[model samples]
Target: MRFNDVIMALLVIVIILMIIIPVPLGWLDFFLALNISLALTILVLSMFVKETLEFSVFPSILLITTLFRLALNISTTRYILSDGKAGEVIDAFGNFVVGGNAIVGFIIFLIIVLIQFLVITKGSERVSEVAARFTLDAMPGKQMAIDADLNSGLITENDAKERRKKIQREADFYGAMDGASKFVKGDAIAGIIITVINILAGFMLGAFTMGYTLSQSIQKFTLLTVGDGLVSQIPALMISVATGIIVTRAASESNLGTDVLSQLFAQSKVLYIVGGVLMLIGIATPLPNLPFITIGIAIMLSALRLTQDKKELEEQAEFESEQEEERDNNDIRKPENIIPLLQVDPIELEFGYGIIPLADPNQGGDLFDRLVMIRRQIALEMGIVVPMIRLRDNIQLDSSEYLIKIKGNDIARGTIVFDHYLAMSPGVVEGEIEGIDTIEPAFGLPAKWIRSEDREKAELLGYTVVDPSSVISTHLTEVIKKHSHELINREDVKQLIENIKESNSALVEELMPNLMSLGDIQKVLSNLLKEFVSVRDLVTILETLADYARSTRDVNILTEYVRQRLSRQLSRTYFPFGKAKVVTLEQSLENMLMEAIEQNENGTFLSIDPMTSQNIVASLAQEVRKLIQMGEQAIVVTAPIVRFYFKRMTEQSIPELVVLSYNEIESDIDIQSAGMVSI
Candidate 1:
C-alpha cells in the first residue's frame, strides 16, 4: 500500500528482469557504478562496526547484493556478445585502467578473481564455520554464567533475559554468515567462467559473422573481455574482503581501524628498534640508500613524537597532583581562604589508587554508571532526590581501602579486593569453596574474596556472588538510606514543592506561606526522614501539614500527624505480611511519659529525671531484644499521645528500633504483640 513496504520487492524484481532483458548502455553504466559503490560501502562498514550484532543484517544484504552483481554481469555479457559494446564504464576500464594492453589487463583480472575465490572467500568461510560452531558450543557455559549472576543478584531478571536474547542472536548471525560465504565463492568462480566465454564467443562471432580479420577480432573481443572481467571482479574482491573482516571481528569498544592503529603503534621502544634495524640495513648492506634511509628517518621521528606525547601526558598528571598539594599548602598562608574550607561536597567516595581502574571509564570501568543507577534506585524506593556524588582518589589510604564521606566527615569505610568476587552465603551453603574470609560491607555478613573463576561455583553452592564494584555500590546505597534525612535541606524541600505544584498548584499554593513557612515544612520532612520514613508522597505530607498547622506550629507534632496520615504506606513498608510484630508499652508507663512531656517555644521535649529515663530505656531495650531474637525488627507501639514522648526518651538507647503510634498502623493490619515494655 505504501512505497516503503514494497520498495525492496520492486528492486528484486528489477534485478531479475535485468538478467533476462537487454539493458541500454546508459542504464547499464549506472548499474555498474552502483555495484562498485555499494561494495565499497560494505567494506567500510565492516571495518567501522564495533560489534558483530551491530551488523547482524549484513548476511541478508550480502545475498541481495551478490544477486544484483550477477544480474549486471549477465546484462553486460549480452551486450558484449550481441552488440559488441557494454557501456562507457566497461569501455573506460578497458582503455584507461590498464593502458589499453589486453594481456596485462586480463592477467590482473585473473589475479583478482583467484585472490577473492581462494584467499578471502575460502578463509572467511572457514572462520564463519568456526565462529558458528564455537558460539553454539559455548552457549551452555554462557547461559550458566547468566544464571549464576542472576541467582547471586549481580544482575536483574530483565538483564538475564536480554543477555540470553543477545546470545541467540549472535549464534544466528554466525550461522547465516557461514552459509553466505559460499555465495561469494560461487560468484568469484562464475566471473572467471563468464570472462572466458565472452572472449571466445566474441572472437568467433566477429571473425565469421562480421567478416573481420584476426587482428580486428582479437583487438575488439580481447579488450572488452578483459575490461568486463576487471570491472566485475574488483567489486567481488572488495565484498569478499568485507566478509572476511566481519567474520573475524572480536569484541571491542572501538572500531577495527582504531583498534589496529592503537595496538600497532602502542610501544615506542618497538618502533625505535624497527627504525634502527631499517637504517642498519640501508647503510651496512647492499641496498638502495635513498628509500630505506628516508623511511627509517621518518619512523624514528614518529617514535620520537610518540615518546614526547607520552612524557607530556605523564607531566600533566604529575602537575595536577602537585597543584593539589601546593594549593593546600598555600591556603595555610592566607586565613582569608576559609571559603574553600567552608564548602563541602554533599557526598564523596574516596578510594585508593589500586581501585582507579574500576572508577576510570577509559579502562572499561562502569562505576559511574553504577552510581547513576544508585541515585535512580533511591529515588524510586525512597521518593527523594539524591545529590550528585563526587569520587576522588586518596593516595594516602591503603590500596584496597575506601571511605564514604557525608559533608566532609567520614561516616563509613570498607575495603575491596580488585579483580575478585565477594561471595557470601544466603543462610545456605552446600559446599565450601576456598577463599579469603572477610565481611560484606553492606550488612556486615561473613563473606569471602574468591577468584573470579570460582564465581559460578560459589553461586551454584547457594552463595551470593558480587563483583568489587557491586560490593562498593551496595555499601554506598545502605549508608545513603541510613542518613537520607540529613542529606536534604531547605533548597531540596522547595524543589519538592515546585515539582508537586506542576499538577496540583492549588494544594501547594494553599500549603506554603499560608500555614507553614519553608523552614517549618523542611523540618517536618526531615523529622519524617529521620525515622526512615519516605517523604515521597509530598501531596499527602503537604495536605496533612495544612490540616494540622492551625492546631500546632511544632514540627514534631506536625510530623506525627503526617505519619498517621501515611498509615497505609507505613503498614505496607514494615508489615508486608499483613501483620505487625511489635513491642507494646504498658498503660502505666504511657501515662508516666504523657505526664513527663514538656513543651517550649523551640519544640517539645521529654522532661524526666535521668535515673527514671534510664530505667524506662532499659525496659524498652529488653522488650525490643525479644522481637530481634525472633528475627523481627525492633518496633515499639504506644498510644498516639505518648508515642513522640516515648521515642524521644529511648532514641539514644535504641536508635535502630522503630517507634510507631497505634494510630500509625492501618485498620486492616492485624497487630501481633511480640512483647510488653514497662518501667
Candidate 2:
C-alpha cells in the first residue's frame, strides 16, 4: 500500500478508539480527555505528513505540550481564586493532577502509542533490503569478458589472471567491514524502561517540593503552588506524547522490529506515553513531591535513547551508501591496478641486417633460411602473441618489396629488409639505397637477381612486398593467426617446389606414366621417382664400398644410413644459417623486458626499436643470445608496446618500440634481423 494510505488507515483506527473510550469515567477528567484528543490528532497528522519519528515529531510534541501546560496552569489559578477555598482548592488541584491526571492520561495515551509504533516498524525494513540488492550482482559478468580475451590470446593470460584476483580480494574486504557495523539488537527497549522510571521520579520530586515549600511560605501560596504544578504537568504530558511519536517512528524506520525491548527503547511513542503518565501523576496524585521529579527523570532517559538511535541510523545509512558506490565500480576494473595487463600493441619485431635478398651466398645464407630466421627472431623479440608479416621482400621472389604490418623502428626495419636481400641469395648484388639507408648503412638486391625458388618461397610465407601499414587490422589476434597459417602453408609448398627443381627428373621419368593430358601429375611422379632413385643408388654404392668381411652388420648398415641422410640433408638445406626452430618465447621476453626496465637507472621500459634495421637485428641477436644461454622456449607477446616510459631516461621519457627479447639465435646471430611488426 502507498505510505499515505497506510498512515491514513492507522489514524482512522486511533480516531475510532478515541471515540469509543468512556469520557470522564472513574477518575478521568473532561480536560484530560480533551488533552488526549489533541495529542492523538496532532500525532496522526504528523504521521500522515511523513515527519521523521525521532527528531522532527519529538521536538514538535515537546513545544506543543509546553504551550498546553502554560494554558492549563492559568486556568487552574483562576478557578482557585474564584472558588473561595483558594488554599484548599489549590492543594486539591495538585492531588487531582498527580492521581487523576495520571489515570486518565494513561488510558488515552495508549491509543496514540499503538498506531505510531506500527507504521515506523515496517518502513525501515524495506529500505535495508533494497540496499543489499544494489551492491552485489554485476561483478562476475564483467570478469567473464576479461577471461575470454585472455584465453583466446586476445590479451595476456597473466594480466587477466592478476586482475581477476585483485577484484576478488577487494570484494572480500568490503564485505567483512560492512558486516561488522550493524547495531546490537534489543538495546532500544532497555532505554525506554529507563525513561519511564526517570519520568516517575521527576514528577514525584517536583510535586513534593512544590507542596512543602508553598505550605511553609503561606496558606494562599500553598494553594497557588499546587495550582501551578498541576498546570506544569500539561507541558510534560504533551512532551511525552511528542517523544512517543518520534521514538516509535525512528524504531520503525530502523527496521529492528517489534520485539518488546527494541520497541520500548526505539519507539518514540514510549516516550510520549511516559511523558503523559508523568503529567497525570503530577496533576492527579495527592503526592505532589513525587510526580515532578519522576517525569523529569523520564524525559532525560528518553532523550538519551533517542540520541543513541539517531546515531545508529546515521551509521547504517553510511554503510548502505558505500555498498551502492561499490555496485557502480563493478563496470570497470581500476585503471591503475588492471590497465597494465592488456597488450599495448599487437605485434612488434626488430629486423637487423640491412634489407637484401636471402639467396646471396656471399651474405652467407639461403633465402628461405633467412626468412625462417627472421620469423623466429620476431617471435622471440615481440613475444609473438600475434603474427608478424614481412613488410619488405626481395622482388626476385615475386613477393612485395616491403612487408605490411611490421611494427618496429623504421630505420631498423628498412636496414633489415636491405640486409635480407644482400645476404640471402648467391650472386645478388647490393647497392646503397637513399631512402633505405638512414642512420645505419643499408643495401638492397635487384628483384631479377633473386632465385625464382626464393621468390616463390618468400611469397608463400605471407611476406608481402608491400609496406607494413597496408595490412588490415594488424593487431587483431584472429587476423594475425589467419595470416600466419597462410604463410606456413606457403613455406611448405615452396619446399616441395624446391625439391622438384633440384631433382634429376628425366632419369627417373623413364619408369613413370606417359599420359599427355596428366602432365602435372606425371611431373610430380617423375620428381618423386628421381628422389627415390638417388636415395637407392647412394645406399647401394655405400654398401658396395664398405668392407663387408671386416665390417659388422651394424657398421655396414650405419654407413649406408649415413650416406642416405647426408644426401637428403644436402638437398633440403635452404638458409645457410640453419633451420628455424619455433620455441615458446613469451616468458623469456617478459623476463628480459622486465630486467631491462629495472636495469635502466632512468626507469626506461624497452620496446622493439623500429629504426635502423641493423640495430634491430643486433638487438634481437643480443636477446636471442641471452635466451639461448638460459635455455628457455620463446612465446609471443600478443600486445605491442604502444607506450613505455623510463624515469629520468631522456626529456621525452617514454619508450616506444623498446627491444624485448632475443632467443634461439643460431651461432650466426647476424644472419637474421628482427623487423618491427606493428600492431
Candidate 2 wrongly placed segments (more than 4 Å) = 1-142, 145-191, 208-477, 480-679
lDDT of each: 0.88, 0.36
- Candidate 2 lDDT score at position 487: 27
TM-score of each prediction: 0.74, 0.19
Candidate 2 lDDT (Cα, 0 to 1): 0.36
lDDT by residue for model 1 (491-600), tens: 89889899999999998888779888999998888888888898888899999998999899988889999999999999898889988688998888888888888878
In terms of lDDT, model 1 sits at 0.88
- Model 2 is weakest, by summed lDDT over 10 consecutive residues, at 180-189
- Estimate the TM-score for candidate 1: 0.74
State residue 258's C-alpha deviation in candidate 1, in Å: 5.1
Candidate 1's clash total is: 0
